[model samples]
Target: MSADSTRGAPCANCGDYAPFNVGRAGPRSGKMLCDDCADDSVAYIVDCLDCEWSYTCEEPRYNWYHAKIRVQQEGNTHETEQRVFENESHETVWRNE
Candidate 1:
């Protein structure tokens, strides 16, 4: 698709602008956000177009405990980083960094 095609568009994962996004939370993914949010969310997959980055949100926006999230992407697969909510901050901790 042309870059202008998605101009002023929002990413499904990141909560900003880009081609599109995955969705919100739960069994069904949420709508798109933006490139920056996409990077923060930790996608099930990712594809960078131009200098901007686009990514896919996980199936469930949260986790078993119910907190925020952030995944990773390398090539076709996403480097899983399941941050769970816990500790004093009610944060989500993942296996990855």
Candidate 2:
């Protein structure tokens, strides 16, 4: 996602004036968060296996299999879901939920 200029407003989660991005998942959903706090709140990264496309989501009722099915049904093929962990900087490191 693109970073938005907060124009000196502090992050909603961490109170930092750093460059902020909109949080797409977890408790921070819809709120502006600093990069570190945004990364910390993500619970999963849904990716399309056929293309370099992905998004982060954190509905408590949603799981990897559910996300995969939803994505495929929407006409995207071969989607995968990877659980996110705290302090991880890259999606390359994955583990089963």
Candidate 3:
């Protein structure tokens, strides 16, 4: 959750203190991660993962293990495009969006 509005604020990045607001999420967690945090997290994940691959900023915002995916490249193919995997042994129970 985020404030209704964030005016005259500090950059979540450099902390230079400017008019900044929350940024859109990247791969891992889904919260009101600031712009600076988002950038750092992206770089960190990219460097650690060692790939120029893309990601999906889809639903199941707060829980990755139970989220539905919406692909950026709807009509594409790759051997390992799925960023998150599901455990095959568990039976699935769908939830309303």
Per-residue C-alpha lDDT of model 3 across residues 1-97, encoded as one tens digit per residue: 6655545444333555443343543233433333444444221111112334443333333333233333312212221333324222221222222
**Clash number for model 3?**
1
Better of 2 and 3 by lDDT: 2
Candidate 3 error regions (>4 Å): 1-6, 20-41, 44-97
User: Positional deviation of 70 in candidate 1, in angstroms?
Assistant: 14
Residue 70 error, candidate 2, Å = 13
* Ten-residue region with minimum lDDT total, candidate 2: 88-97
lDDT (Cα, tens digit) per residue for candidate 1, span 1-97: 5445433454444444455323422122344444345335332534433223344445423331122233332322321221232222122223321
What are the lDDT scores of the predictions, listed in order?
0.34, 0.42, 0.33
Q: Summing lDDT over every window of 10 consecutive residues in candidate 1, give the lowest-scoring window.
A: 82-91
Ranking by lDDT: 2, 1, 3
Clashing pairs in 2: none
